[model samples]
Target: MAEQDGAIYDRLTRVPERDWDKNAGLDALLNGAREPFVLRGFVADWPLVQAGQRSAADARRYLLDHARDRPFTVSIGPPGHDGRLFYDADMAMNFRTGTGKLGDIFAGIEASEAQDDPRTVYLGSIDIPAHFDGLDEANPIDLGDRDPLHSVWIGTRTRIAAHNDFPDNLACCAAGRRRFTLFPPSQFRNLYLGPIDNTPAGRAVSMVDFDAPDLAAHPGFVAAMAEAQTVELDPGDAIFIPSMWWHHVEGLAPFNILVNYWWRDTPAWLGQPQEALNHAILAIRDLAPEDKAIWREMFDHYVFANDGRVTDHIPPAARSVLAPLTSESAGRLRAFLLRALNR
Candidate 1:
């Protein structure tokens, strides 16, 4: 398959798998390396997985019984989109979104199955605790004291284009199967990134379609594919995606649901480095080549390789801007940026 298609490279890496247990040693897995890894049998004993093993109807019942009849957001698209939700020619979403009850979506799924229809419905990223009250208690992953924000994605054979999330993620398969094609942050240049301000998804997505990639249009995508790794997860299986790792997700089965936990290890005061990069581009990108070269050295010395000695040459009392970055210091920086921008 890889040889025939230039988008699917033959020498792609594989994600390491770990067995699920009460003591899964997640801290070691998370803290040691920022690489993606899977945990087999992670949520194997959850009621949702058991129900999925029985039948789609059983899984639907388990969810409806837990979440009740509350209205949730659902996205609908024609088969032309091929279950891939993304932007069209005018930068508008190819699909449309509407709020509806969960039962309506499940019924739509069943009806579509019976009729062999091409229209698809998706209830993506619904808050578990807010919508489904008692569901979290029934199925828990035991992530220790750190309470991660939980969300669920329910759909039928959907594909999400390659995009990166800011927080570290644990995506657990509750029902059906999923395939993830992951690329490291370094592959960003070859991915053909789309608009930053306007996006179909929350983040800037790659214009190249993974399933039917047009190599002629996006030649650099071949290089990105060479560095890509694909992983398939069954019900009860889970995968950890480190922050800023680009991933393309595909839900394989007719009826599927994924529960994911997202959390960040860094302090909130540190903020997102992506924002800083955007600001740097605005402030420094248009400078003369010589000026830019000089700024690069300044950044390297002060920002990248400053191991506590970059500002050591300056008196501690006078190093107000270069001082240690505490929450108060961050607030002061924010105020300075606000004032500079307003001017």
Candidate 2:
């Protein structure tokens, strides 16, 4: 991340690009992709893309016209930090957020763009259907039975630290140029993660600065770099990021806008894995080694096994929680956990 910036970018594998027209629909493509891929000119026909292609002003107008005139949250990062929205020395957020109409926010962003070193202005994870009127109908991807959480991201030139999310992402660059540096889920140990609960965003992000990583302090990052995949997306290009894959994003253009879809492969009622992790940390993390080992064996038997070892001992009707979980069973399990934790 020092003298090796160009080398790192050059050595990394570019994310493969696919043709959306030539291939199957989005859901099918995603089901097969298992990894991140680019779709060049995927949404070139969309009104949003055409508007942005004409001018950023046109794009802003298009969005404002479609928007419901509701106040939207914007993240404003102070200048002098190289446009990176991260933390200060005290681990507090480096950016302040305020809500404004899209037009006002875009005006502020435009003003900032004129500055030599502009303030980082970002509007992230905005629910498209809730705030925008008829845009979802006008510009839509056929996700085919998968009702994803459609969202939009708007920002000036900025850097977002590497982070993972629970739901897989399909990110479409509606306006401006953007670069993504992605790492596999296995690179967890090398990414030098920040505090889990107190994150800049909801998801935990890598503490390492991609532009200038301190390799000596974090030697494992070198291994992470070896596995990195970097790709730059132009307007109308899209990328598929598998759930839990670490990604560092850069808004290359002065004004950038992205539309993304997020959804889990698992059903909604199954419960969040992160909560289970927190509960495990509370219950098992500090246990004595021998006790921990026993608990690990118990977990393997109960939660993480496929040998039919559990069912071999129990009858069909008696295998209540052990059986395939449905919405009802998951609800019951949550209720049981709450009662147990409270006791």
lDDT of 1 at 179: 83
- What does candidate 2's lDDT look like per residue over 1-343, in tens digits? 5322566687789998776653467766877557889989888889999999999989999999999978998999888887689989999999998999888898887777678987889998899999899988889787777779999999888889999888989999999998899999999999999888898778789999888778898899999988999998999999999988999998888889999999887899998888888889899999999999999999988888845887878888888888899898899999999999999
lDDT winner: 2
Go through the candidates in order and give the clash count of each. Answer: 0, 0
- The CA lDDT of each predicted structure is 0.84, 0.88
Best by TM-score: 2
Which portions of model 1 show Cα errors greater than 4 Å? 1-11, 68-70, 287-291, 307-309
TM-score of 1: 0.89
Question: Model 1: how large is the Cα RMSD against the reference?
Answer: 2.9
TM-score of each: 0.89, 0.95
The alpha-carbon RMSD values of the candidates against the true structure, listed in the order shown, are 2.9, 1.8
